[model samples]
Target: MEQFIQDWGYIALFLYSFGGGFLALAIAGAFSYAGDLNIYITVIVAGVSNFIGSQFLFYFAKYNKSYMDETVNKHRRKVAMVKTMLKKYGSFMIFIQKYIYGVKTLVPLVMGISAYNPFKYTVLNAIASAIWAIVIGYISFTAGKLLLSFADDFKYVGFFTVLLVLGILVYSFKDKKKVKKQ
Candidate 1:
């Protein structure tokens, strides 16, 4: 991973595309700190990458609404429940939905089809993206620091293991809620 980071310098394409969310954030954060904050290149990179990925998903949902509706119709009760929740909660659903594995991709698109306002969409998504970037970036940055401090020791392995576990747990909970909604 270090070699990969070294090779690309500030670009974390591989990590953003393939790494688990937490790992990507942690690495971005660590790199930002390691570079001494001369500029927020790492943060901006991670933020932009994440925002682009998320917006792609959102656009997919927007474009594929009919298809998704057909798929969701296979379970009408679930769709009805989601619609009710979305109606009752308004824009907060977008923020809450990001915790789920793929719902981040879905909510914005789905909301676009609903009564949600575009201005609300812009505000909610931007805020959510910023928070997500900061949280992930900080974790990655701190992970890098820990690895540096204990370079010769085996604790770095444990640190990463903990990160992996936490990520899995968070994803799992999100998935579980999605299943329940379905």
Candidate 2:
């Protein structure tokens, strides 16, 4: 991963930040903490990448308004609720949408379809992106620092966590198989 980051530089980080969401951003933060990259630059690149990605989605939905509406109509209630929120909140909605788990992409697309002003959306999104990037990156960097301090102790904890995850996966898979057979 370090080699890849070295080779690709900020472009790789941009792509990762654009699509990778929380996990990818956290990993990039960890890399920055390790001196493989610059935290400030990472934050900027992530913010810009996220802004561009959202803009692209917005434009796509804007141009294909009919299709977008048709697709969203399947969830009419949810769409209406989101539209109400966007109307009532506007800038605040755009600003905090990045932190909202499922609506990160949907909100921007909905705003576009709703014909919200492009300039305002861009400004608000840029601000939100910067804040989100900085906050998440800092948290991840701090986490990396703490992890390094307790590396030896964390090995046992990591092993247990992995085992627990695997156990859950196995149980879920078995449950699914049983349901299918029935």
Candidate 3:
């Protein structure tokens, strides 16, 4: 991973973040925290990648509206709810779509297919991407830093903690079963 990042630089970061989603962005952040990459550059690349990928999906949905409509029609309630939200919120929906689970791809595509202004979508998406990148990147970087700090100690402590939890769970299950049998 380090080697790939080192060799490919920002291009690799862009590609990875494009398809890899949040997990990929987090990994990039971890690398940045580890001093293998630059955090600011990583965040920018991640934001751009997310924006491009989302736009691609939006265009695809826009171009294939008929087929998408067929699929969307299968879930009328969900589609209606999302449409209502988009109608009420407009560009704000696009800005915060990335933060909402299950709607990241759908919202953008829906907006595009609905002919919601492309300029607004683009502007809001760009802003959202930057915010997402900054927030997620910082979280992953801090997590990575903490994990590295506790690397050696966590190995032993984590192992025992897992064992202790497992033991308690097993004991509780057995006690319940024994009571039921009695």
For all candidates, the clash counts are 6, 0, 0
> C-alpha displacement of 78 in model 3, angstroms?
3.3
Q: lDDT (0-100) at residue 155 of candidate 1?
A: 75
Local accuracy by lDDT, each model: 0.62, 0.80, 0.80
Candidate 2 matches the true fold with a TM-score of: 0.75
Instruction: Please provide TM-scores, in order, for all candidate models, with all chains considered together.
Output: 0.59, 0.75, 0.72
Candidate 1 per-residue lDDT, tens place, 67-118, comes to: 7677667756655666776888777877676556645545655665565666
Query: Over the stretch 4-83, how does candidate 3's per-residue lDDT look in tens digits?
Result: 87677677778866652787777777778888888898888899999898888777888999999898888778778788
Residues 57-129 of candidate 2: C-alpha lDDT, one tens digit per residue: 8888889988997888887777777788887986798777787777777888788887589888888878888
lDDT of 1: 0.62
Worst 10 residues of 3 by lDDT: 16-25
lDDT of 3 at 22: 81
Clashes of 2: 0
When 2 and 3 are scored with TM-score, the better candidate is 2
